[model samples]
Target: MTSMMAPNAAGLSDADIANLAAHIASFGGAAAAPAAEAPAAEAAAAPAAAAGDVAAGKAKFAACAACHGMNGEGQGMFPKVAGQSADVLADKLKKYRAGETVGPMSAMMAPNASGLSDADIADLSAYMASL
Candidate 1:
């Protein structure tokens, strides 16, 4: 089988993914278990939150508040940023900075993200995660 598929190509949720990982482990194919991705991805991101200062992020978030709302509840056409995973936030910001379009907000987000440094992105990610 291929190593990966769409998140729910098989109609599996996060819990389902874990169960599949367990089954893979039981089959003596631990090395091929897709569930191991959880830990590896987590390990890779472990330093991201530490690299940022929450206070600074809150200050940085002002630009985003116009659309996302102060509490990240989002408004009108904007999506909520609060409560998002730091990893997700960092990735999206990076993509936006690189001129990659994520969705309807891409045009708006790119300009906002363009001037952010890595540290700025980290701080925003950390603060968003804590929301």
Candidate 2:
């Protein structure tokens, strides 16, 4: 079998790092990257948020209130989502939908995120960030 280095071990080109930074910035988050292969980590977390309707996002968020609370404050064991950048929220939801484990809540979140379309993600992210 061919040996594969870890993404960090392999490192990233300058162009790749710049692209990752741009992607993060588009999501309204600060562009931060290590001097090494930081692009791998950033790329994994980066997802673009499409334009969304805040009103609709609010309506959609009601379904999430059971765990996240009406204001996205999050209840016990459900981490706070309010004020998170749109890109972060969208990327996390996307990962959950794809059944990729992100944290302790991965199993619980998978089902909730499974049915979300890109538009849904965008709307939800917008709503959560506005909180």
What lDDT does candidate 1 reach at residue 65?
62
Task: Please give the range of 10 consecutive residues that has the lowest summed lDDT in model 1.
Answer: 29-38
Q: Estimate candidate 1's RMSD in Å.
A: 17.9
Pairs with steric clashes in candidate 2: none
Q: Write the per-residue lDDT of candidate 1 for residues 1-131, one digit (tens) a residue.
A: 33223422355467756755554344342222111123656747575556888898997776676557778777666788889888788878877877789987788677567767678889989998889
Off by over 4 Å in 1: 1-47
lDDT of 2 by residue, 21-94 (tens): 45434444332221222366665564546586677788777657656776888766678999999888887887
Off by over 4 Å in 2: 1-47
Residue 87 accuracy (lDDT) in model 1: 76
TM-score of each: 0.63, 0.64
